[model samples]
Target: MTDLESADRLTEARVALAEAMALHEQGDLVAAERRYRAALAQDYRPADVLPLLAGLLGRLSRPEDALHAWDQLLAIEPDHAVALHEKGLTLHWLDRTEEAIASLERACALDPDNATALGNLGVVLADAHRNLEALRTFRRALALQPDNLHLRHQVRRLGSGAVPFWHIPMMNDAPRNDAFEAAIKAAIGVAGPEARVLDIGAGSGLLSLMAARAGARKVVACEMEPMIAEMAQQIVAQNGYAARITVHAKPSTELAVGAELDAPADILVSEILSSDLLTEKVLDTFEDAHRRLLAPDALVIPRAASAMGCLVASENLAGYAFVGDVSGFDLSAFTAFAPQRLPIHGTMTGWQRLSGDVELVRLDLTQKKHDATLARLSVPVTASGRAIGIVQWMHIDLWDGVTFDNHPDGYHDGGWLQVLHSFPEPIDVVAGEVLDIAAGHDRITLILWPLPRAAD
Candidate 1:
């Protein structure tokens, strides 16, 4: 065709595409699909029209066609950000996560400030279980658009919920903190207040600053969570311990003994145990520290931790424990995926214990390694009721005299929550009978299992 004829055909194509979109807005998806394909046949860059066409196909549940259109567009415009973004989303819907991440990452890199690209990248990363990097990406998007509620929710959800309220008081638990302080003080005494110290998982930089307060010449602490680590660094300065403490933004694994520190640490103080213990990988962190970082006989804070619990029950909690059919139909099948462990506000959520507190899992931190083990324990019921499960907490035995824990009975309003290790279902029980439970830790997570009630 002549150039004039070619231009006329292009104008006609654009008009036809516009009419097709109007039809689409009028809910005539069939006509829109036809026009979109017609426009594609005109030898135009498919990438220009493919996004809308693919979106329409996806809306119609024709994912196969949508995928084909996107793949074609990608071939034409390899770095097309929209095409990459849409393709990644489609791939994710098709359950191809790794490829989706790669596509989304490419899209984000191509358009660094593209909020949609950043948010999509974050979502894809999170789906792939790369939670840390996902969080960073989400924050970057938020920095561009702070008012984004979706981004805000993702951040909150990714944080695994705010640290339970009782966690702080529990961390400050005198018995726990004093034990560690005593151990720390003793370590500093021998190290002559000049021994360099390394504190990993510096929640509040409390330990490193404590060492400095105790006269250590230098104490370095590392916290992986950026916000927390930054806060620690500031707190050190505000508390007049800045000169003595250095806060590093990293997990202990990221800290090289010689590079991040002058030499092997003379003493190591770290507290990163989750309520169940080891869930925070405290064992792994300490093992790595000892394997290559700490000197022999270096003081390790929280020499031990124990997961304690009581078979608990409350009418208020039964709703969370057992889900029976409304009219005796078998709706129980839906409850199979019920949470094995639930975090409840011990102070805010009113619940009564049907069984006395029992020591379940005890983690000896002094040990270098651990293997999972199951042991039988007979717990006596303290009150009569339907037993839902065991409400568990931790007791961290820190250096010398410091201690920290939310031992449900007395701990309230801190950064940790008493974990309700909900049973698979509820069990009716009477007072004076022993509730059998299985409890231990694989050096990572506290294990609590409700055993079958003996023949009722």
Candidate 2:
């Protein structure tokens, strides 16, 4: 072809490209797509034209066509950050999280300072529940733009998450705190404050401080929770007990005998017992501490604990424990798997004892073997009402005769919520008859089984 013919072809392509842009500006999308494609057919800057056309196709709800356009562009510029980021966002929208994270990560590596890419990476990481890493990335972004309101909100959001309702009630429990404090003082008094004291599960560093106040020369405290440990360290310093207390923010399981505990401790004080008893792995922690960390006959602060409970019924709590019907579906069958041990706010929620607080289960934490045992307990009914089941709770023995308990009768608030050991069904009874029931614990939980009543 002559030069004139080539010039004519070039002129036609440029005119078509201009028409596409004009049509796109005028809201004639179909016409714009047609003109754009016609120009592309004549080879008019395919790299620039393709991305715009693909985006328009996407906006027009034609993902399949848009995918083809993007695929072609990616084939040419494999590491193009824009293409990778957009494609990853599209994949994420499609719920293809695995591929989306990979693509977005690649885009981020290619363009490190890309705020959009970093922000998207943080979002996808959060969606995948990688909270720690997501937190780190968010912090990085905030450092880049400290005044960003959205990032600040995200920081606040995660910080306020998991606001446990039981925490406040537990914190304000005066009786529980008093009991623990007394136990700590008793321990320090017995072992002598000059003894190498090891306080495991240093909650708020309260016990450790008590030891320091009692004049302990060296106090080594380990907190299983990082946040709590940090707070405890602060409290220890604030109270002038920092010289005596060295708080390790880690589980007792992770603490090395000779490393974390400088020397074999003469006293091991820990408050890791769950309301029911063994759920906190107190047995495991104590066994390890006793076996490796403590010297022979080291006074275990909570030398022993007994989970004491009684048989009772409450109309108010029955609703939470059993559901006969929900959304027109018979959910009574769910009662079969209903929690044997239910946590109730004894200090807060409305619940009345149907029977006197009977000793249903007694766990002697001092016993060497804590397998499982059942005993016939004849509980005298103090108040006459329908007995549903045994509502079990704890009576802790910190030292010889030194104790703390949230006895359902009076103890209220502090970290622990009362455990309700719901029975299979309700039993009608009156005052003055001995309600025979199996009451005791397997060290981990309180057992309450109904038995034939003994004639009073």
Q: If scored against the real structure, what TM-score would every candidate get?
A: 0.67, 0.74
Candidate 1 TM-score over all chains jointly: 0.67
Q: lDDT of each prediction vs. the true structure?
A: 0.80, 0.75
lDDT of 2: 0.75
Tens digits of per-residue lDDT for model 2, 34-110? 98898888888888888878887877977768767877789889998888887777777767788878888899889
Clashing pairs in 2: 170-414, 170-415, 173-413, 173-414, 360-439, 361-440
Model 1's lDDT to the true fold?
0.80
Model 1 stretches with alpha carbons more than 4 Å out = 1-15, 44-47, 160-179, 217-263, 272-293, 304-410, 413-456
Native-structure RMSD, model 1:
5.9
After superposing candidate 2, which stretches have Cα over 4 Å from the reference?
A: 1-119, 144-150, 160-163, 172-175, 185-250, 258-265, 323-334, 346-348, 364-369, 400-402, 442-444, 452-456
